[model samples]
Target: MSPRSCWIGSALAVVALAGCNNVSNEMVKMPPPAVTVAQPVEREIVHQLEFTGNTRATEAVDVRARVNGYLQKIDFEDGADVQAGDVLFVIEPAPFEAALDAAKAAQQKAEATLALANADLARTQPLVQRGASTEQELDVKKADVATAAADVASAKAALTQAELNLSYTQVKSPISGRVSRHMVDIGNLVQAEQTTLTRVEAFDPIHAYFAISESDVVELMAKSPGTSAASLKANPPTIYVGLTGEKGYPHEGKLDFAEAGIDPQSGTQMRRGIFPNADKLLVPGMFVRVRLPVGSPAPGLMVPDRAIGMDQSGEYVLVVNEKDTVERRSVKLGLRVNGMRVVNEGLEVGEWIVINGLQRARPGAPVKPERTTEIVEAKQLDASNDPAIANSGAQLSTTTPAKASATGGN
Candidate 1:
């Protein structure tokens, strides 16, 4: 019985030892995990401050009736483009015409009186010298001439005023722009200097206004030494603008104006940009996206966003060395430009970064890194979802420069 038991135990121990040897051989023969790696892309990137703004016409005018009269005719259709001096409304010009004719007649009569006064003065002067007329009579004639001359001048001034009033009857646009609908319909009486006829707004070369925070302004000033609000206005920086539903900032402009001081209540400074609206794409009272580059373009390194990972130590990336060893690198990241994450520090250009199979990579362990030449195309930065910009709270909107009056007639 003892011999049988010992033999059975010996056979079991041998089987266990053989199983352990097989497991060890399998572990040693297993290959390293394959991972996709790419070198960090170097690009020229500019840090831009973004904001929401509103567009307004460069020149806006509220056209009004200068003379009191009934609106006889509307020469333009609603929302028509008009040039300066284009007749928009005829405000009972017939009455003004009659008044002008009467003034012309009065002016002619005054001129005749003036001519007669001069003839009389000439005749009296000769008579006074020849002693044909007494001194007192000559003086009386001179007084009569002076009085007639004054009356003629008064009549002439009246004539000029009448002509001006007549011209005012034909309401003309004072600026070249798109006109709003007429405020007063035909046969409606409009008061002089009080009636708002319509509005005209210049579209080409439009204005876009946005507000920037005082903190951001201070940062900008620090970046550019010796730069002040006045200097910014005098030598404007390039700006980009985009309307709602538009991709990127297609319109280019200049930061033409900046407020002298930041508003204490809002802690922001008003800034204005002027853009060419030759295509008529930009309209007043439209919400737009604006971008202003902070400093000159600088070189930066970027990697795919998926390649980055966060931990208790903050953001880190899996980098592969020349020996195919994986290393965990703590990196300082900036804004996301395009779709790539900007590596501000702790990463170098041309260093291989794990793009795929990150979970399979372990620090200080060997990996089969598959090198990839693919890179993200460096283009315009979309700051809409950038956490850096969102944290700064730079996206803000302000009131439009000019509001169209609802009561004005087009």
Candidate 2:
């Protein structure tokens, strides 16, 4: 009886131990962590290149005195709008008037001398023909007449020069534009073609200059050969200029010119646009942003910033597979518009991605997805939802576990 009882008890104990081990293993096996997944969304995307540039007036001019004299009057007010040929200053004309009078008197005296010489020549010709005067006398009288005619021509030229000088006494603007402050005020002596009296800047149809990368120029030219630098003057590209802190483009401009060669130092091509500043709002040396349409818009895919993850390798996003499992996906990015990113590759539309609870998520782990809006509501309901974590999770921050998983998965 004792041998039979001992054997049965040992066998039962061994079976029970084996059963307990199986139960322990079963209890330790836990399901994958719950994660929310999202689908790759489809939307229209626009590719754009944003660059910082400056505004400049298309043309600028400086007004100066052509003749030297004391400025008797200022015809234009400082900072006043003026037209081409508008009087800007008036120099003292007294000296110029005296010169004109002297030139006219000299001209009249020369004319009188020419008339007397002609009379003498005529009289000598008759005498020579009648044999009353020597041929040498006739020749001398004819020479006198020719000299008098030359004197008359010289006097006439002097008179014309005097008139021109007199006209120059009233300094007129060379171009239509806004007149700057007078460099030389009234009663100040200015030199001829040497001293700059003031400046006149053309505001209407002003110019804006900007630079584009050499690569961009090459791409653009490849797409449209007609838009090369050589043909820019005849058929220039259109440009739009917008001021900082302003809404839309205030002025539309046309490409006027481009540099013949790329700038070696910057590796950029300089381009110019002409804009109409009829309102006088645009000025030279003003900083402005320029927009140029280089290519046609194409349809593409995009995702929110929260879905992208970045690490040493590059940018990527989390993709939920058909089995409702998370898989890290490496992506090629194109442009950033608003807060969204253009997905150049590595993602297809309508694929789910984990957007929330990413801090606790890992690659290939099972996820329990809640709508993004639901997550927001839950965070609002539970004050303990650490807004920072919720926001980070919402944004799929790279430092978070889900982002690490994406990086690891990649």
Candidate 3:
């Protein structure tokens, strides 16, 4: 081979190396992923706390026999409404009547003896003054009159007691409420205050008892300055309640009682709400869901519920920073209101939250964010439809501010 051919080969190899270097230095750049972002919706919303509880009768009484006698008649039907002083049972009155008659005869006899003794005393007074009768004899007559008078008084007292016993034969209801079935049948011997005849319970104005966690109580007190267990008596917050198989909290009541302190073992405090149960829907021992508004209405931020993401760290949202970079933010959530989740904490009102195209965004990655206004429509909150409550199998119920206000509260 010639020297010229070798030099040309070397030059071609250098040119090829220079071309490969130039090609590697040039880079292919791709545009950032596109995502839809929206600012948090600000609205006037009332924060609500929910709890589970049980219903109890406002007043419950166990009717018992007051006198020892054989039951002659049950005046009221089983499970009937009874008024105060209504005759519920009739004991055998024949014995009481005979005793009363005997007492009356004894009283009459005592009175006749006292009248005769008084006449003797009157006659003896004059004899004693005239010395016709011995002073000792007059004194004996006076002492006999006093003893007869005491016997008359004792007989009168016995007669009064007999009358009371006769009246007790007719057992009357002590309160106006629904009456339970008669436990003792007719001809059954009932003892005084020993046998339970039946049970009567007042259904209207039922009570709901629940426990509030200590942390929740503290949060409530912080939100409302004067709210405390003691203050509940003076300024009772309105309570909304719903029974099992019910939708939202349809029944409304007021906080009636609260324990003086929280229970250390359970970290909760006992609370009671009194609800009007005119329809008799609330029954004793019925499980119920309670919703209590913690504070007055205030401005709050909300986002679409779908925008929330969950991981081991808890619920979070994808945020697009001012530099158009994706960022992950951990957030605390509240009740679902108007198809949106309340941002209890960790999200600012002005911050942009990723509402759509979440898959296209990654933390610390550049993103092409498109600003959009989220449309939030207010609607009736249904317990069965909310996944947050339904999936957890919690008895807690929630309501929107509008529904809460329309239901009316104290």
TM-score of each: 0.72, 0.72, 0.73
Instruction: Count residue pairs with overlapping backbones in model 1.
Output: 7
lDDT of each: 0.80, 0.72, 0.80
Give Cα distance to truth, residue 74, candidate 3, Å: 1.9
Error of 2 at 295 (Å): 3.1
Error of 1 at 381 (Å): 8.7
Per-candidate clashes, comma-separated: 7, 12, 0
**Quick one: best lDDT, which candidate?**
3
lDDT of 3 by residue, 1-410 (tens): 89999999999999999988876665789887778777776655667888999998888889887779999999998988888899999999999999999999999999999999999999988887988999899889989999999999999999999999999999899888889898999999999999998988887889999999988889988986445776876778778888787756779899888888889999999989999988887888899998877766666677888789998999999988777778999999987754578888999866777888888888898887777653432223323333223222221223222111221211
Which pairs of residues clash in candidate 1, taking residues 3 or more apart in a chain or in different chains? Answer: 180-410, 181-409, 181-410, 182-409, 182-410, 183-409, 183-410
Clashing pairs for predicted structure model 3, backbone only: none
Best first by TM-score, ranked: 3, 2, 1
Model 3 scores worst on lDDT over the 10 consecutive residues at 401-410
